[model samples]
Target: MGIVRNGHEASDRWSYIRRFLGGVAGIADDFLGWWWRGKDTLSPAELAAAHEQWADRAEWRLAQRAEELASDRIKRYLVTSWTDSVAYTSRRLAAQARGELSEWIPQRERRPDLHTEARAIFADILTELNIQSQPTKEQSSVVHLRKAG
Candidate 1:
């Protein structure tokens, strides 16, 4: 019965992990919907549809990345690390969405460097998905101001 009990315990642990991962994935989806809201003028339903598309693309990209890793263990670790990062970022974004926080960075100040980094990540995803990037008003003004300066 010890062998059966060990197998059951392992199965239970795997089930718990799967559920936790699903919750994190949901949080990431929620955060993406919130982020897309400020980027586009789409209605909530349309934004949700777009979010689904983007999520699928992201998953595909992540799978491709995982496949590049040398070992199955390393691939699993990479995917878990990526999932945890996304969950943490999503929590921060959700706080911002609820007006509990001001940017991801403190100080009520904009971080152009971080913004650029984020845009580059999104640009890669967009390029992979064959979607065009839309410049925000702030992005457009920054270009104009740079030219003027």
Candidate 2:
């Protein structure tokens, strides 16, 4: 009775997420499918709803964010973001394969530790690009020549 109380399941479970579960993705999606049981089966109607509810918006959000960044900075900033993701993924895969991740990463400090890792990688790339050493030019500037008698 205590376990099956009303509103308990409703509050604890996000039933809507079931709609999006499928072979549509890679490792993460596969893991999710494995985690879900018979009762948590995905329905066809819900799958369509999931596409309408989240997937479409995710694509739109990606484009919108790219536009916002472009308006704020140069295209290189966008390229840097892509490179950062690639570099971070490669580092994480290598560390995970080595099985030494736990040695340096505490379960409790995981999020912050990962963030620090990514930041260090990004900083290294920035240094390699020599971006920090360059100074920005002013919009308006004039060269003055002195006349000698």
Candidate 3:
């Protein structure tokens, strides 16, 4: 038989059991409360609004990216064209200055229309240069929206 101490031992054992059970109950209650708070509570309209806002932001970002790419392409084309034109003009002017045109073209043949060629080349260069200097329409197409506080 188990030892008995005037019911004191049984009482102490019951107290320890109660304390352990109470701690477990408190923990369970806290977990349930947290789970309830963490549950999805958004209405359909709220969810839809959030999605629409995300899509709008995405579209705006894509448009901005496209504009940036277009600007870069235009810049590269302009620079390359300008460099090629400068090289060609330098070679032609140097050859003409050195009187090497006769070697390239027969003297008996009518001289090639240098004035017309020069005018055409300069016009093309100037047109492209002017275009490079001006802002593209895409740059101005961006819409600025002020956020409401």
Candidate 4:
């Protein structure tokens, strides 16, 4: 959540209204609310576009944060691990032998966190760094009537 302050209101006409707006996640109703206050709700297409843009920025933020916080050695190890995972060598070899098309797609065989690698990594990094969590310096992407509508 973010606050919008009007320094020079000039008696501007604005109404504060919030919506969960789970449409971006393709779940119109969920506990994790995509809460944003605005004069109005966004059109479906516009909401999707906004989600895409926001997600890209969020990913970049995570990458930058990792580089800043992790040691050079840890960073190198992470780079190697990520690259190796993308190659999926076992699947590649399997495909060469069995010619299974599905082998091309990367699969997480067994993980503590099944659907979310980010959750696992977040916990791992925090443990390694001896920190609980770090708040983002940037403000949340609080959608507004202008940013969305």
Give the winner by TM-score: 1
Residue range 22-141, candidate 1, lDDT tens digits: 222223323434454443554544444433433343354365456455465434544644644454454453344444554454311333544454566667767967734667788999
- How do the residues 1-97 of candidate 3 rate in per-residue lDDT, one tens digit apiece? 3223333222232221221111211221122332244223434443333333333322333343454447564453443344334334434434444
TM-score of each: 0.29, 0.23, 0.22, 0.27
Model 2 Cα lDDT, one tens digit per residue, 5-100: 222221113244333333222312222442254223545454333323333323333454565556543353444444344334434433443443
Q: Which of 1 and 3 is the better model by lDDT?
A: 1
Compared with the true structure, the alpha-carbon lDDT of candidate 3 equals: 0.38
- What's the CA error at residue 105 for candidate 4, in Å? 12
Task: Mark the regions of model 3 whose C-alpha exceeds 4 Å error after superposition.
Answer: 1-71, 102-149
lDDT of 4 by residue, 1-149 (tens): 34333321211111111232222222332213443342126454444433443333333334545655476644544544553453344334334434345434333443223325555666787796774353333322443434775
From the highest lDDT down, the ranking of the candidates is 1, 2, 4, 3
Whole-model Cα lDDT of every candidate shown, in order: 0.44, 0.40, 0.38, 0.39
TM-score of 3: 0.22
Winner on TM-score between 1 and 4 is 1
Q: Which of candidates 2 and 3 is the stronger one according to lDDT?
A: 2
Off by over 4 Å in 4: 1-34, 38-40, 72-149
